[model samples]
Target: MSGFWGVARAIIGREFLRFVHQRERFLAALVRPMVWLVIFAAGFRAALGLSIIPPYQNYITYETYIVPGLCAMVLLFNGMQSSLSLVYDREMGSMRLLLTSSFPRWWLLFCRLLGSTAISILQVYTFLALAALFGIVLPLPGYVAVLPGLFLGGLMLGALGLVLSSFVKQLENFAGVMNFVIFPMFFLSSALYPLWKMAESSPLLRDICAFNPFTHVVELIRFLLYLQINWGALIWVLGSTVVLCTIAVWGYDPARGLMKRKS
Candidate 1:
């Protein structure tokens, strides 16, 4: 038991240290969403007016409506950044060393996921504080209430990243792949606009967005930030996390997975 905890601590500590050293990564993570919130949302505020939506009893500004989605954006990008590091580590042979250690592979991967999720939570809180300073504040208790949703959403995105990393064989190829995954996942979801808006435009596109796990992730955070719960979103996010984690474990399996091909 002591050994297990020890390994967990070590891996998590390593992730923290790596994040600290990469100051630009943190800046980039904050910048992308802040741009959307401050500049893009402002321009679009008049262009895309929002009616009162669920978890929102009154009509709100575009900035307020998108806060939760931007928070989820932070998690989504950070999750991918963590996966980028995993691919980098694998290329450098460090990932192989970690996997070959006496610790179980799944445990190691879980620790990595936990570490990334913790960092994502920190970044989300920081973003929320900044948003508050900019005059977009949620319910006070909602700040506290949203932690579990953030943690679960982070894990789901991080697990998806893990699954991607296991399949990507080289560091050079990851950036293009990330763009392919990230942009579609972000733009197609409820992050920028509501699903009903999408439905108004095209029911097929709306259905696609509803099927997206990232949509549920955004909805989960959005509801929690209002001190409410979206049961459907919660269930979808939970199930997606389980399925993604299972696929990640399989992807890293020695005999039957991509790791074998890499080895």
Candidate 2:
């Protein structure tokens, strides 16, 4: 038990240290969400009207309505960013070192997920603090409640990156993958607007948004921030996490997909 715990700790600790050295990563995480909250929200505030929604007993500004979405955005980007780093680690040979460790490969990867998720959660908190400074604070207790939702969302998204990393062969190809993956995941969901708003434009689009697990993740945070439980969203995020992690483990299996490209 002690040895297993030590292996997990070492893997997680290395990930934390990598983030510490990369100050630029922290800045980029902050910038992406800030652009949405401060710039995009500012422009759209006049165009978007709010009716009373769940968790909001009174009508609130569009800025407040999307705060949770933007908070989720931070996680979305950070999770993917961690994945990007994983790709780099693999190319640079650090991942090879990690994989060859005495611990089971699956356990090591799981530790990596936990570590990246921990950093992502910290980034979410920092973003929230800045949002509060800009006059968009949630209730204090809501902050505490939202942490678990963030963890689950982070794990799901990070696992996605792991799966992608296992399949993608070259470093240069990542830009194309990001374009195909990240933007669609962010825009097609409830991240920027409500489902009703999307329904007005096209029912098909609304349906797609509803099915996307990213939608549930954003909604989960939205409800949690308001001290409400969104059970449906909770289930969707958890289910996706399981699926993605399973695929990742399979892809990274030594006798199979992981070494094929190199061979």
Candidate 3:
């Protein structure tokens, strides 16, 4: 048992070390959300107007309203960024070495997910801290409570990334996929605005956002931060996680997926 844990620790440690070596990656992670929260939300404040929303009572600034969404945004981007690195690693041969390790592939992939999710959690905390500095803090317990939600959400998104990595041929082609998948997933979802807002804009858009797994993820975090349990979100996220991870395993199968490409 100790040996098993030790191996897991080693894998996680290597991932953390690699992350620290690429400090610029952390900076890039912070930049996008900051732009949305600080500049974009700031500009949209007047245009967006105010309505009392769930998990919020009375009036609130547009920046405060979108804080949870932006937190999810950081994780969303980081999850995909980690996947892009995986494709790069596979091309560069590092992934082949990792895959050939004595541990089961699922275990190795789980360890990779753990490492990426840890980094995502750290970025979320940093974002919340910066938000606090700007007067958008949640309760201390709320921060603690939201950890599990973040973990689940991070895992779900990271697993999706893993599934994508198995299919992506090269790092260069990731840009087009991200443009089509990530942006639409994030925007169409209830991440920035509530589903009702989308309904007002267009019921079709609202329905799409309602079905988006990312929307449930953001809703889960938002509710958890307010000390509420969003059961629907929890169930949807758990279901999606199971589905994506299964697909990822199949996609990484030796006789198919990326294995055939290398052979």
lDDT of 2 at 206: 100
Between candidates 2 and 3, the TM-score winner: 2
Q: Write the per-residue lDDT of candidate 1 for residues 1-263, one digit (tens) a residue.
A: 99999999999999999999999988888888889999999899999979988999998999998998899999999999999999999888898888998988999999999999999999999899988889998999999999999999999999999999999988999999999999999989999999999999999999999999999999999999889999999999999999999999999998888778787
At residue 225, give the lDDT of candidate 3.
Answer: 92
Sort by TM-score, best first: 1, 2, 3
Instruction: Give all TM-scores, in the order shown.
Output: 0.98, 0.97, 0.97
**Which tens-of-lDDT digit does each residue in 119-141 have in candidate 3?**
99999999898888878877689
Which residue runs of candidate 1 sit more than 4 Å off their true CA positions? none
Candidate 1 global lDDT: 0.94
Evaluated against the true structure, the overall lDDT of model 3 is 0.88
Give stretches of model 3 more than 4 Å off.
Answer: none
Task: Please give me the total number of clashing residue pairs in predicted model 3.
Answer: 0
| Candidate 1: 10-residue stretch with minimal lDDT | 254-263
lDDT of 2 by residue, 1-263 (tens): 89989987887898889889999989998887888889999999999887787877987888888888887787777777777888888888888898899889889889999988898899999989999999997889999998889889889888888888888887789879978888999899998889998999999999999999999999999999878989999999999999999999999998887766744
User: Which segments of candidate 2 are over 4 A away from where they belong?
Assistant: none
